[model samples]
Target chain A: MLYLEWVSFLGLLGCGLWIFLKLPIEASQGFPQKIMYLHVPSVITTYLAFFVVFIFSIAYLWKRELVFDQIAKASAEVGLVFCALVLLTGAIWGKPTWGTYWVWDARLTTTLLLFLIFMGYFLLRMSVNDRDKEARLASVLGIIGFLDIPIIHKSVEWWRTLHQPSTLFKVESGQASPSISPELYYPLVASIIVMLVFYIYLLLLRYQTEKRTDRLNQLLADTQD
Target chain B: MKTRTKFVIGGAIIFAVLTALSVQGLQEMTVFFYTPQEVLASPGKFENKTIRIGALVQKGSVEWNAQAIQLSFNITEDGKKFIPVYYAGVKPDLFREGQGVVVEGKMQGPRFEAHQLLVKHSEEYTVETENKKNKEDYYKSIQAQ
Candidate 1:
């Protein structure tokens, strides 16, 4: 697993660099639009990570298995990192495009709320001493936090926001169509694939570390007895 | 009932209630931005409600007073339907005639009283040759004037 992770990581880095240097600059956004390749993929990966957390949280609660809990915790941690990257790249893009670094638009506000809710989930875990109780509470929070995903996805359509609607999945006049030009679409797809593979690699590494920690704790508990 | 069954049912109930509330909130909170044609077509429906309208700035319609900090322009769609806008605020640097803009304000009779104005710019990068020619032409036009 470690060997595979390093190989994929190197491949992702190479692909990312190639796309950055070779992709054609958009006519309107010029250089700033390049941030989209990073920003969009980060947000997509964040959503995927949270979805993993949601599923594993439900599994943990249903089966009362420590492995499921470990996976949920690991995914949440990774999701939070990607969510923060989304915000950072978004802010960088916003400064040049919108003439402001931030706005209280519905989409932006909901995304921030999503980030905060997960932060609360982590805080709740740290405050609890009992392992089972902590898992139960965090799983519940994780399930509730997943609700924000749909809200964030539809915020642009649901409210008047400074943020533009999705370019890839445009639903204008009740018709869904992709609006991206071919020149921009291919590189974006490549970037998203690279980011997603990297996300999976990180998730596997985090899960392995979590399993090791759990084993160490069990050994220590047995020795104390 | 078993605790596991209870938790599953309770989680489902909470999820349902939250989804319902979100749908209700979205209905009330959604303020759709309209074009000039849409607003003009249904003037009575949007009266006094804060709404956003986007269109191209009509050429030669801009009136900016730096000292008074007042800006006014006519926004047009299809170059036929025009909505006059009056705004008292700091205009964005990109505010110019023949550019796309979206203004948020309430409609008062035939005019839009704007609270905020956002300049909508394209994502395309200007080519170097075009940029140089534009600069030269701008200077030449100013000298001619």
Candidate 2:
């Protein structure tokens, strides 16, 4: 786990160097376009983290297990942070390229909606006291919240948007070819892979803390009894 | 009982906020901007109504007044039909001829009065060999500034 953290961190640093020092300036956006390295990967990671939550939440609901719920909660917390990262990096990129930091366009708005939904997921977790009740309700909300990802992902295509459509996910005649040139595309893929590694490391670390806290709470409750 | 009330209130608030935001988002998502064809076809409908028009900046139709700090350009979805827009703001960094833009304002008697101008970029990324020459000129423009 420790090595995983270091590897992701160094991998990101290497990607940053590659973006700035080696990559050619984009034809239209030039220098500020480099922020895509940060923005796109965070977007991908946020999607993946919540996806983890969605899967485990379903698992918890079906199996009625604390471990599944623990995993769901852990991923949701990490996903929330990554979702925030997505918003922040998006705003930073938007200002330089789109001439504004924020817009109420569908793609941007739905992404914000995802962030708020998960924030409420945490708040919902805190509002309930009974462990089973909390897990049950939170899992339901987790599943509902994850459905928004597909909507967010397709917003650019489904409606009018100031934000551009997916660069990497662009399908050409049923083939998976990204819209980016080869020189820039490879590093973007590298960053997304590194970001996923970092996400795994964080999820494991947070899951440990969640498990310990649950055990400590049980111990305290027994002592009080 | 106390936690129940707290939970109800918190949940209600979250639901309310989410509903309100999505309603707004739905509006924007549905029609972030209308096309020139739509706006131009029913000129009376968009007139005096504050709305957005998204289209490409018509080639050779941009006029920027440095002293007045005003920009005027024609936007067109097709080659034949064009809508003239007047914007009283500094040109956006990405603003260029043939670039896509969304202008927010109302339609005047003849021209569109725009208060905000946003450049819409494309998803495709490409590197051109001739861009090298443009990059040098771009650097010169920045250094000169």
Candidate 3:
């Protein structure tokens, strides 16, 4: 845990310096293109965090393990933060380049839906009083909510959207090469790696807190009895 | 009815309405804009209806009326078929010739009058060595454009 914390902070610092100072201004969008490092990394991290939630939710259902549920809950909290970051950063980036902050296009709308579904995930978790019942219901919702990610990802191609298609994941000639130039692409790759490390650190910290909170609640219930 | 049953019924009603509204909205916005060729292909079909057309801003066809606060440009797909567009709005920062744009408005006779103009940035990225290395050069480049 200590090592992850150190690595992520230092990694992020290095990437930040490399991005702002070392990188050249992109041709079309000028300085505003710098937001891509922050925006894209958070987008990838959000996808990964929810993917963790999806996995653990399935594991909890299969094994009926409270630890699985706790892990899923921790990852969901982290995912929600990153998801909000995606929306915020995208909006800030959009104002200059796209000429609008928000559009009701499929990509933007489906992402908003993902955020809302998870908001309801927490609400549903809280509204149910029984611990086991809460886990069961939330796991189901988590599974259902994850189904939106694929649709959100494909919406740009499936529908006409103002948001540009994937730059990093662009596939041409059966090879996976980013449309971004090498000078800018390398730093973006570095930022994404550092962001994932940061995500792992957050997940571990949140999981510890969730575990302790459950233990404390159990202790209080025993004392009251 | 029992309290639990009433609560269930209320929840069901709310869910149904929310689902209906979203489905309707989703259907409407699924196709955000039509290509220039599609509009040209069927002009009478889209005559007065408010629609959005996505195309590249034609080169050297832009005329900005600063005092009147109107921007007029021709949008084209293959450099052959063109539709002249008149917009009354602030010019977006990225608005320039040869860039992709999506305009929302109605077709007025042979010309299109747009209310909203959005720039569609390409996925490709490049670093212009002479144009974008420093702050002054960047400003000069944009000014040159």
Candidate 4:
């Protein structure tokens, strides 16, 4: 299963790279617009990962299952990584376009808050000693942290921000129209798919590692007893 | 009430309060960037408020004094309604006439006191095919049209 996952990951990554390179350079942004392929995909995947964390967290709270908690932890860890990548890519793109590396615009501020919330979630998880109590607390935080996602999504529209409003999904008109050209749009979609697959693969690997650690702890306790 | 019911109600109340607070904050904090026409139509509303306006720089309106680091330009949305903008800073490399720009500042009567000027670069990457025409000739052609 692991081997197959790795092979498919490489295949999807190869496909994504091909599509990304083939995307036409934007007339105004020129080649710098290519960063959008990476930036957009990472953010989308980060949202997906966080959503997984939310679902698993709720499941853990409802069923009180260790497996659900494991899943939530794994997904949140992966989400945090992707969240950092999103910020990194965004800052890199902003420097050339917005003339500033960082701004306190609504979108940027909300995203930073999201990153900090997850960081706090991880810190809380590590600080707690009791397994069940830790899972319960983390579950609550995981659910609340997701509240930032909608705020982040709407920030560009809600505030006076330098960040451009939604280009892929314009909500006001109730239409799913993209503002970008088809050449750029297709590659962006391709990159999102590739990143989603990569996220799921990482989540599974991390979940397996968590299960192994739990089993090892059980074995050690049994030996001591 | 049962413990689960109590918990649910408490969570709902907290969520509602947070949502309300955020909604209120967003309404008060959101400063929408206005076009030149929008600013002109309601100039009284924007007085003393830090806001951003985006428009095309009017041709032949750009004046830069390098010694004082002062740049002045007129921006317009429809070429009929123009707003004079003054800034004292190193201008962006992309600043040019007929280019889209968004300036953040407060309105002082007829002139905008811009604290920051951002050049709105185009997203398209078309190859430059009309490089032979000089800057003045290009400006003249634009004006002639």
Candidate 5:
């Protein structure tokens, strides 16, 4: 699973870099500003993966299915990791462009909050002993907590904030502007597809690991009985 | 009207409220930038509005008043354009002339008043990641042979 996951992730990463490098020099902003593609897409994908967790959480609550719970937990775990990457990359980009790696503005603050919520979600899961009860609690929290993701995403615009306005996928342009020439856009889209493939592949591996752990736990209980 | 249905409806309401809050947040996340040339050409577009200006420090424009701990410099996107900036704050360690920089503040009167100035530096420090460093060292040894 590790090797397989790496292959898919690396391939996607390679494709993304290729597309990013191919962008015309005359595009909106020049070379150094290119980090936007990497940082923005990771943030977008983090939300997407966590939204999957929210849906699985709902399914787990409704049907009490262990499979749904597994999916929810796995997705949240991966989402948190991706969210961390978003912060790290954003900070890296921020330092050069914004002059500081951090600001307590709307976008940054809300992203930090979302990071904390996901951290709390994992901590809550660990503190529980009963498998079924843990799933029920986590499912409820996962479904509720994911509400913050979209809020963090849009906080910059809703308030008077010190963040940049959305440029990619703007209503004014059906696609990325000439600012993001096909050179960059193609790689960006490629990176996203690669990320999705890698994410799903990881989710399945983690779900299987959880199932095996549960089976081992059941075996121990039976032995005691 | 089962107990479970009520609980589900209550959960959905909570979800709706939180989603609305998040949507509002997502709308305001990015910061806009403008080069000195852009700001100068359409000062009207950016008039009285908070903005960031990017430029190189003009050759003879820097004036640091030690008493006030303020640093002043003229910036221009290109040599042909220039804007005077007055910043009264502790400058970043790497602040110097002929360097690229971004200043966040607003234009006031004839000067671009800066509330905050962050200096950018290239990454020269290396992280000691064991595997990466080790591999590079190994290749170097092979080349030496």
Candidate 6:
């Protein structure tokens, strides 16, 4: 985990440099548009993390495995942080491009809903006293949350939309136009890889911490008995 | 296999399907943001294409009809770069001279017409500081000339 942190730190530095220097050159015409790289990728990573939470939640419900339950909880927490980042960065980027921090577009609305749902998921986990019931309820919410992510993603295309279309990976929009130059892409990829590594590392730590806490609680119960 | 294993397998399949579906969905939406200079440089792409252009309003460029239903201005990346903008809707409170804005619409001949205009302003103040800077910059250029 420490190593992952180190890698992520370096990655952040690399990405910062790319964002400041190389991005402006590649996207000479669209200076402010470079925020798409950071914003879009973070959203993608958040979605993937939440998907993990959803999958593990289902697994926990079916198997009733403690490990699966912990995974769900861990991923959901990380997913929430990334989701928050996506919104924050998005709003910042919006200021330059959309002229306002907030809008009532379909995509924006769905994203806010997703953020609230996950926040509620965390709330439910905390309120329930019994661990089993907590996991069960949270898992159900997690599975439901997965359903919303797609709807959030598709809202732009499905309806008359105001939000900008996708930028990074577009098959139908034709070839991959380098919004940012290769100088930036290399660092951007590095940051993503490092973020992924950091995510795995954090999940491991969270699972271990949960396991230790469970052991301690069980021991306490035994002593009382 | 036990019930738990069965559940795990089912979950994995669903996960795979959902991931694939989401990836597929990403294909449909590809949005781009253009600045005023970019739109001016390659005018062809925006002739009838819906595009978003971000820039600061040029001084003395805003014009309004008698009824005030329609307004027009030139947006510039800096003082030197400019793109003509035409909007036929109610502008936001923040739409004014030397204000940062992102106008969304298609290019109508020499003018980049806007259907929806979003006034991009800082939360605290939406004043025209760029005017002072541009004034100084203009004087410096005039001196050089």
Which number leads on DockQ? Answer: 3
DockQ of candidate 5 (2 decimals): 0.07
Q: Each prediction's TM-score against the native?
A: 0.76, 0.89, 0.89, 0.80, 0.65, 0.62
Off by over 4 Å in 3: B1-24, B129-145
Q: Score chain B of each candidate by TM-score.
A: 0.72, 0.71, 0.70, 0.72, 0.62, 0.64
lDDT of 6: 0.69
Clashing residue pairs for model 1: A27-B124, A27-B125, A28-B123, A28-B124, A28-B125, A29-B123, A29-B124
Residue-wise C-alpha lDDT for candidate 4, range B67-111, written one tens digit per residue: 999999999867788999999888886677777677989999999
lDDT of 1 by residue, B1-145 (tens): 4986888799789779977986776554454357788899999999989987767788899999999999999988667889999999887766767666778899999999998787654322332323312322222211111
DockQ each:
0.16, 0.36, 0.38, 0.21, 0.07, 0.07
lDDT of 5 by residue, B20-124 (tens): 886575444333346777788887887788887656677778999988999999986556878999999877655666555668898886689998886532211
TM-score, candidate 5, is 0.65
lDDT of every model, 2 decimals: 0.79, 0.85, 0.86, 0.78, 0.70, 0.69
For residue A206, give model 4's deviation from the true position in Å: 1.1
Model 5, A77-146: lDDT tens digits are 8889989999988888776555688876566777888888889888988999899878987888887778
- Candidate 6 Cα deviation (angstroms), residue A105: 0.8
- The runs of at least 3 residues in candidate 6 whose Cα sits more than 4 Å from the true structure, single-residue gaps closed, are A25-31, A173-186, B1-70, B73-116, B119-145
lDDT of 4 by residue, A42-95 (tens): 899888889988999999988999999999999999999999989999999887
Ranking by DockQ: 3, 2, 4, 1, 5, 6
lDDT of 6 at A165: 40
Model 6 deviation from the true structure expressed as Cα RMSD, one decimal place: 11.9
**Candidate 3: tens digits of C-alpha lDDT, residues B44-145:** 899999998877887799999889999999987667889999999988988988777889999999999999999987777888634332323222211211
Candidate with the larger lDDT of 4 and 6: 4
Best of the two (1, 5) by lDDT: 1
Candidate 1 segments exceeding 4 Å error: A171-177, B1-29, B32-56, B59-71, B76-81, B86-100, B104-115, B120-145
Best by lDDT: 3
